[model samples]
Target: MTNPTALQLIARSNRLGADSRNTNYAGGNTSAKGSETDPVTGEPVELLWVKGSGGDLGTLTESGLAVLRLDRVRALPEVYPGVEREDEMVAAFDYCLHGKGGAAPSIDTAMHALVDAAHVDHLHPDSGIAFATAADGEQLTKDAFGGRVVWVPWRRPGFQLGLDIAAVKRDNPGAIGAILGGHGITAWGDTSEEAEANSLWIIETAAAHLAEHGHPEPFGSVIDGYEALPEDARRAKAAALAPVLRGLASTDHPVVGHFTDSDVVLDFVARAEHPRLAELGTSCPDHFLRTKVKPLVLDLPANASAEDSIARLRELHEAYRADYTAYYERGAAAARARGEEPPAMRGADPAIVLIPGVGMFSYGADKQTARVAGEFYVNAINVMRGAEAVSSYAPIDEAEKFRIEYWALEEAKLQRRPARKPLATRVALVTGAASGIGLATAKRLAAEGACVVIADLDLERAAAAAAEIGSSDVAVGVQANVTDEAAVQAAVDAALLAFGGLDLVVNNAGLSLSKSLLETTVADWDLQHNVMAKGSFLVSKAAAKVMIDQGLGGDIVYISSKNSVFAGPNNIAYSATKADQAHQVRLLAAELGEHGIKVNGINPDGVVRGSGIFAGGWGAKRAAVYGVPEEKLGEYYAQRTLLKREVLPENVANAVFVLCASDLDHTTGLHIPVDAGVAAAFLR
Candidate 1:
């Protein structure tokens, strides 16, 4: 057997799509080419060979391959208008092929041409597409690969898509492959065989996994509502669908020939099988830029009256457009916040493609692009299904998603760039620092070069913890009760007097009680509330006064817990206090935001080892009290989290550091979870 050449690998992957019973007529394309290297001079030169348009990869020949100077192709989109630009692109290819004969370039030629790697292959593998199609595509991918894959969310394909891929390449210099939402997968390697093998391997792996988990082919299932529509009604339905499809496709994607006749396209779409028609749409986020989150489903029965059907279809279309606009606006705002330019909204008229009687049509710049949209739809369906299974598939609300989508700092950090060292000259005060989150946070601040003052009720224990933190940075231990206003104020004075100024305050002193709401005494509730909730407020107030007096902005972090939101059974006082702490942080943020004093909280769940809360042989006592073995307590909490790992004090420390440091300047009033996804229970 001979090793497959780059083009052969590309062709083989394309054929595999056929074998898997995926792809429709001109539905997906494949590309394989290498960067040009000067033979005589050995200089690296721009070179790319892509599958030309109008040719299926299964039957593609060398003549079907189009060659272009990579540099020139990458620049085409900027110099021409939509249709004129595409025409000029083909013309350029023709001029390049004057001497050497090959097929006209692919519609996605620009994408392949712009990628930074020498050997690149692009395909819309079914399994890969299916995985991308899900609403939890990122989580699904993580579950499938166990944290070994790179993923890029859906974006409109064209210059923007090319740019995104190029950026990913730079970020993951050694990444095996990347799954593009709704669009497909881009696999690269030192050689074509490696790229193709990896792509095929991932697709097969994802498919087998999904099949094992009961995700069948998306189209095989019968759609309940629209299977029996009338013919005249179908045409009206298709017309109604056109705008919704058009709105989703938008104007930013590569404008191919199929996309030009949006109205006629929808007219044809109105007559197809409803399920099959919807399946024809793109399946992932990569397709979102082109196809909105979901496609329109127009049902026209052969026996139904045309007038009634038309009215029904119009109503459906209007509903779809309204939903799509809302989704787009939400997504646009998120994208903008994440530093990504929003897609141009051409008009109120959507980019929908209508299909008669059968369903509606939604198109992307290309097939893979549409597949991305389809993937999102599929994921949405899965989410709906899972929700049904568990009574509801609750996800983070729109506001939270919006925050994540628009968070510029978060997106920047995804590249794992080391955050800026911002506490070089800062001074910090940490309470309850003898052990647990407080001690960990104090040590962390000291490590970051901040002068740290560790305060605790046990002076000796605080001194011991501070000593272990080292002697280089200014670290002192003070004995004080966080709940006592005078004692807390004295500690603050001592810290400021020692360090000359204060910039960060971590109110980490707290107590937890595990008693039923009715079984708990009023004194227990007051004690827990006064220490954890009231104590945090007093410490924050003192810190803010110092910060304001110094004329320098500062940060205050309250240590909260997962119980704050979930309210674990028998933990009423603890849960309520933590919840109050979170609210207090929010109020402080609003009050001090303008003054440059940022306030935030870290909500940790199940933190073990080096934490006093869990150190008093409480796990054993609780286990005995609950009739479970002490050994199982760790497993109990760990299993509840998505990561299924113990929540270490170090993890909480890292989060506290992130919140207090300047890296979180725009992140005030936020509650960061260092709970390994436990709060996701409430989200789900």
Candidate 2:
């Protein structure tokens, strides 16, 4: 039987987490205390059910809660080794588990276990944290709630801090909650309903106080030259600069990128005090954990040209790296003095970038993470705005920030993350991806952990295909006509902005017409060559520039046809274009080898099903030429192949994956036939 109190706890948690004003994503925990029948003893025992580690309160479920014997949890302080070894208490949480326990306990477990209230909420709400991080945070807490909410000094979260809050609760008889200086707010009540209400009351009270007494322009006046560029111009500049910023951010490892041009970001970036406040960094641990200690602010106005901005950004990046290294050394030195070994440096590249007049760009290993990082920074901006309004905005000192950034516990959490997939962090762009081999290939790459861009002439179909593949962060659909240079370049730019940079390209867009040299029109010849031959060249040229600039090797796979090598009849236009694509693969492979970019090709005989070309009319035309029914074309082609197997779009997609797979890193310039056992189409 499920405990009703546990259900109520999850319900309360979801309600609190659903509101961004209550807490940032995955930034808070809630708990409920109740008595349950102990299976072993057949007697009632008090238990604590709290949100577990690394879970979002909004998505809290029964399985996500950690259950422990309240009596045993309260007894932990007796064995606690003091503040210096407080982390040891976290592991101790396991010993107090009731039955199978539940999810692993979070560090915040100590707070819930030590508190006496029947229900508790520890949240990182922007309104409450504003006063929590204020310069005179203790005084502000008293003023905001008139002593209903007490104040506790900043102490890194641990057993000691939990004990500190518990002592405050015990000392203050009527206090409903307490604000942790330089951290966040915590509230409790005798029931789940009361607890939730108390939390909201604290948040609303703090926010209302700030708004009533705050300055009208807390962020300061907009700089003369830093006014936001017109919307179109701002987005265009952001797209152009994305690749450069991505390259700089990938100094250590490749990362995905996210761009946001919301009004809050625009208003903050254009203000005179943006740089000063940005350098001070974020206060709450949850904010800094995602946004980093501080973002790298581009020192130019939004109207600056891409060429000039890119040049200056490079210079700023070099300096930023050096300063980061210095900061690490300072923390390492401090650790050594205390006889502790510092953790290895993770990366020196900035995770968040602030561009005046444009907006913010945040980077991470994947799309959701990148987006969340940006959201965290927005929360930081809100906290700063509120803090400065009531008092000076003051975050934790640099040394403390470094300590948390490289904490051993944080390192262990990273180590616990699942292993990366084969193509993890790799970004792929596929032409004509709305259907057929292109769509199949896009789906395949995404499954193997690659971020994908589905490019085709039809925007609606392309977007639908991308949606089928994954979420917006993982795959994006783009309208592109391979024959148009501008469209091809735009597609490449979209990939860079959506996923940081491109590492793979599939030239799969083409049309087929079954016509002999005598029957083929000039227009037919031009159409085939323009899409398959010229289109591939445009995409390759555009993508190669970004790959070269990124200084990371890339792969280009051309989807040619068996007709490229075989003397198939009545296919002059199609055959010639396929031959053109096949040779270009080898040529580009040799030329781009110096840059570590691999080029390869796949030759498939007849992909009838799911093929846009075949479905359009090529299937009937080919069936007539081969003296077979249109519906039986696939069967007929299968019977003729040496392997007696029909070639499907998935078969071609598999061949593409093999050519680009890491194991074939040294096998560039090779053409693998996906034509089953067709001897004539074999590469000589």
Candidate 3:
């Protein structure tokens, strides 16, 4: 908070930002103009603070607000004042910063400056967008709020639109706010509190009126909550179908699928008008730019095989892509007919996937994008239902939508962005991620920009690890006991839910019984074999099914040990289980090869620190067997190795990374030893 004026503005902005029903993801902006003394120079100057690009309103903070010289921005060279001003406005945004080290101002900065009010709040509320996009939107705008809100027709967001909005405001200074057709509503006040209350009044009163006038109850479903199904049932379905959808939707591009059957979406889908409404396009221009024209509908029967579902989804994907192409071309032709030069449009890719009888899926380059797209579609569905209740859902023309989608400002954003890491969009599941080699590998994968799911039996620890690793965009933790078929399947589903799909599975969860053959008890043998050997098979089997369905090659890596190749003294159960796991890797590689999946193994020894085995007192006993104290055990192994270096968890993780990397892109059914130099463990 700065001056009282700025504090009030920031408070109201943060209040609106906290609610998705108000300002979702990056879809809204708030601005307040006030006098502030320069940090370097004690002279006061008029300053405008607006929500910056790429910042979410719900989490809006002081830093997220871009500070700019108000007069400097309003005076920005509007070379094409009436024709276009986005380029110039953007340039002004870059150069007019009143403070150092802040994000770029929101694209609506020009419009914010033009408005005459001391405080302005803009939001894409469901109720507001529903009214704005209806067929009779202009008239409805006048009737719904009874002319208290001025109406402005759709204009591309920039200087000219700002001028048009200002003209409307200047002409009607008595109105509280104005609704932008096919966009959203903007309200202003002298105080931040008044601005917020005024904006709320417009939205809430509009919503109440719509409800009273029969706005189809939005979703019109029996369920009263957000959930689509019973908690267990929903989770089970997600687990069963996530990988299948992942493989199908990701055929050409790397897309992660987000599943939802919220009451809103489910009710909309259940409606008789659902199919028509689904293809009618997004309700607002901002969402339209992200969700494309429509979603792909798929028929998923309850008893379908994974293969059947995947094959059917693939067909739908191809058809969706083809239809999108036609839609774009038609829009382009229409633009030319209107004597307007069409901008270069990107290729058609279905952003939303509707699976009847199951739920909905949204796809994007990563998890967050997919989730945000899904949220927008849900809001859109509700808005459409509300509009359909009163009148037809009349969104902006295809020309206007094209303008928003391929606008030069957005294109510049694409160009200015940095290149993503090699595995930036890839998704992976790492078992035993709570500690040791699995933990190290999970972090490494996250660092490489792959969305990772840390699956471990230690549910709390797994989640803790995920938080330590990073954002939901990159990591999540799920409890998965690899030995249980149900648990393994659940783990895969969790991975798919968290990351949209799985491209790699690191089967590294392991256990050991350092006992001689005669000394190994039945419980020890069962536990060791079940965890190491059977767990590996269960996880690999589940992973292979997903990879096979994906039709895109994937990787399944087993964390075996050098003991698999060379059994040492007093190690029976551990060595045998590892050997079994190694064989299973080759078998999976052989069978899943046709599906383009690669199966590999990493054999690493002397991982003393950070491993569960070491924590469980295996290191001390092993050191006793080596005729040395526990403290010297690490050094002893290091000296015994050809390289005379310790075999660490990171070393094992590096080998895992190599197997998953493009270097071994063509190789499969191979084992790479991570020990410094083990001639016998080496693969010739």
Cα lDDT, all candidates? 0.60, 0.91, 0.79
Give the C-alpha miss distance for residue 643 in model 3, angstroms.
3.2
Estimate, for each residue in 385-472, the C-alpha lDDT of model 3 and write its tens digit: 7687777888887767776776667777767676876676778899999999999999888887788899999999999999999987
Assess the local accuracy of residue 320 in candidate 2 as a C-alpha lDDT between 0 and 100: 88
Over 21-65, each residue of candidate 2 has an lDDT whose tens digit, in order, gives 999889999999999998888999999999998999999999999
Given candidate 2, what's the lDDT at residue 581? 98
Residue 136 of model 1: what lDDT?
65
- Cα error, residue 6 of model 3, in Å, equals 4.6
TM-score of each: 0.39, 0.97, 0.92
What lDDT would candidate 1 get against the real structure?
0.60
Model 3: how far residue 137 lies from native, Å: 2.4
Look at candidate 3 and tell me the lDDT of residue 382: 67
Q: Name the runs in model 2 displaced over 4 angstroms.
A: none
Q: Name the lDDT value of residue 677 in candidate 1.
A: 79
Report the error of model 3 at residue 427, Å. Answer: 2.1
lDDT for residue 629 in candidate 2, whole number 0-100? 99
CA error at residue 110 for candidate 2, angstroms: 0.7
Residue pairs clashing, model 3: 17-57, 17-58, 18-58, 247-550, 257-500
Clashing pairs in 2: none
Which candidate number maximizes TM-score? 2
